[model samples]
Target: MAHILLADDDKATRDLVKRALESDGHKVDLTQDGAEALDRLIAAPEGIDVLVSDVHMPGLDGIDLARRAIETSPRLKLLLMSGFAEELDRAQALKSPNLNVIIKPFTLEQIRSAVRTLIA
Candidate 1:
């Protein structure tokens, strides 16, 4: 199983995603914001296999966090989520090989599939 670092400002969304990923047999480290996620990634760069983050947050956003994380962990897989169309557009423009953007209101199965594809 892969180690996933999940970041989302919404508590309900974060919890739901965590449970879905965990049910798929992955170990997840949950964070409420991008700053905290970045700190965790920096603390143990090699420990995380994938980063699933929300696009919008109070501090650093998912796109910025993913960019920074890649600087430290080049191979880190990214799955960015956002309900905002503009945010999704920004994520798509990143054009990174290991990065993917998922729109919000997705089913648990969809997220599980995305995570599986990322780690595969």
Candidate 2:
């Protein structure tokens, strides 16, 4: 199972994602914002395999988080989620390999599949 770092301000979304990933037997670490997420990533002695974040957050939005995270861990797989078209567009503009985006209002199955594919 992969160690996953998930960052999202919305509690429901965070919990939902955590639950979905956990069901797949992945060990998921949750963060409310990108800053905390970055901190966790840096502090992690055992590296994280995947990062799933919300594009819109209180501080250190997903795009910037993705940029920094990728720099810090180049092999890190990333998935940015957003309901806003503009935010998704912003994520699309980032120049990072192994980066993927998903629109919000997705099913648990979809998210699970996305992560499965991401780590595959």
Candidate 3:
């Protein structure tokens, strides 16, 4: 199983994702925002195998977080999520080979599959 760092500002969304991923046998670390996620990544660069973050977090949006995380851990796999088309477009424009975006309102299976595929 992969170790995943899951970040989202919404408590409900974050909890749902964490439970879903954990049920799928992945070890998930939950964070309320990108800033905390970044701190965790910095503190233990080798600890996480994947980052699944919401695109519009308060402190450090997912795109910026991914950029910074990649700087510290270049091989880090990213799965960014958002409901906004603009944010999704921004993620797409990043042109990161290791990055993937998931539109919100997605099912648990969809997210589980995405994480599995990204880490695979």
Candidate 4:
């Protein structure tokens, strides 16, 4: 099982995603905002293996948050999810070569598969 840091502004979405990941035996540290996520990531870089975040959010946003996290921990895997296609594309264009992405309204299997593929 992996330790994942989940950063999303929506409380309901964050809760649901956290539960889904936990059900699959992954440990999830849920954060409601990007700044807090960055702080947590910096505080425990080795404790987090993957970061699953929503692209469009208040404060730091996912792209910046992911970039900062990567700077802090180069090995951290990033998986982005967003409802906005344009924003997602823009973020992807600037993302690290190995970063992964999933669109919003995805299935549990999709999330699980993405995580597995990265970890593998």
Candidate 5:
């Protein structure tokens, strides 16, 4: 019942995540990079409940995207995913009740559960 923006460079990951959230009845917007995701969020900051993004991308990475997203929409919840532990560390500065991180190779159930918890 929420609107979600998912950003990832990997097409397969994006599709999988989109399907996962969509099946849960969320309206999912797909973006190939953090820059695109930022643009979408900026263009329409309203109604986006959660942002599930990959921590590393081409132009704008998820960490920076999260920062900008919060500025654009402070109420937005964030789920930043990454395979690299270093990137996860970079997210430390963004620690908040609204922000969470998932290690890569996550299960669909885990992601769904995380999102549910985030938006709860």
Candidate 6:
């Protein structure tokens, strides 16, 4: 099982995602704001293997969070979800081949599949 950091502003989304991941035997840490998420990532204890985040959020956004997280942990894997996926930078979008950007309204299976792909 992998340890995941989930950052999204919507409470429902956060809860649902957390439950889904936990059901799969993964440990999930949640935060509603991007800035807080970044801080947590910076100070996170060991075993945090991946980050799943919404694109738009108060304070820092997901792209900034991903960039900073990568800086903090070069081995960290990222999955960025968004309602408006086009708003992110084109270069960054295409930069990391391992990055997964799931659009909003994704199924639990999709999230699980993405996580499994990264973990595998």
Stretches of model 3 off by over 4 angstroms after superposition: none
* lDDT (tens digit, per residue) of candidate 1 on 1-120: 999999999999999999999999999999999999999999999999999999999889999998898898999999999989998888888778999888989999999999988878
Winner by lDDT: 1
Candidate 2, pairs of clashing residues: none
Q: How close is candidate 2 to the true structure, as a TM-score?
A: 0.95
Assess candidate 3 and give its lDDT.
0.92
Tell me the tens digit of each residue's lDDT in model 4 across 13-33: 898888888888999999988
Show the colliding residue pairs in model 3: none
**Which window of 10 residues has the lowest lDDT sum in candidate 2?**
38-47
Residue-level lDDT of model 3, residues 1-120, one tens digit each, is 999999999999999999999998899999999999999999999999999999998879998998898898988899999999999998888788889999999999999999888877
Clash pairs, model 1 backbone: none
Task: Write down the lDDT that model 4 would get.
Answer: 0.88
Tens digit per residue, CA lDDT, model 5, 13-106:
9999999888889999999999999999988899688999999898898999999999999999999999999999999788767999999999
Identify the runs in model 1 with alpha carbons over 4 angstroms from their true place.
none
**All-Cα superposition RMSD per candidate:** 0.7, 1.2, 0.8, 1.1, 0.8, 1.8
Q: What are the lDDT scores of the predictions, listed in order?
A: 0.93, 0.92, 0.92, 0.88, 0.92, 0.83
Model 5 — which ten-residue stretch has the worst lDDT? 88-97
Order of the predicted models by TM-score, top scorer first: 1, 3, 5, 2, 4, 6
Better of 2 and 3 by TM-score: 3
- Tell me, by TM-score, which candidate is best: 1
Clashes of each: 0, 0, 0, 0, 0, 0
TM-score, candidate number 3: 0.96
Q: For model 5, what is the error of residue 10's alpha carbon versus the real structure, in angstroms, after optimal superposition?
A: 0.4
| Candidate 1 vs candidate 3, lDDT winner | 1
Better of 2 and 4 by lDDT: 2
> How well does candidate 5 match the true structure in TM-score terms?
0.96
State the lDDT of candidate 6 residue by residue for 58-101, as single tens digits.
Answer: 78888888877777887888888887747545325547755777
Model 2 accuracy (lDDT, Cα): 0.92
Question: Clashes in candidate 3: how many?
Answer: 0
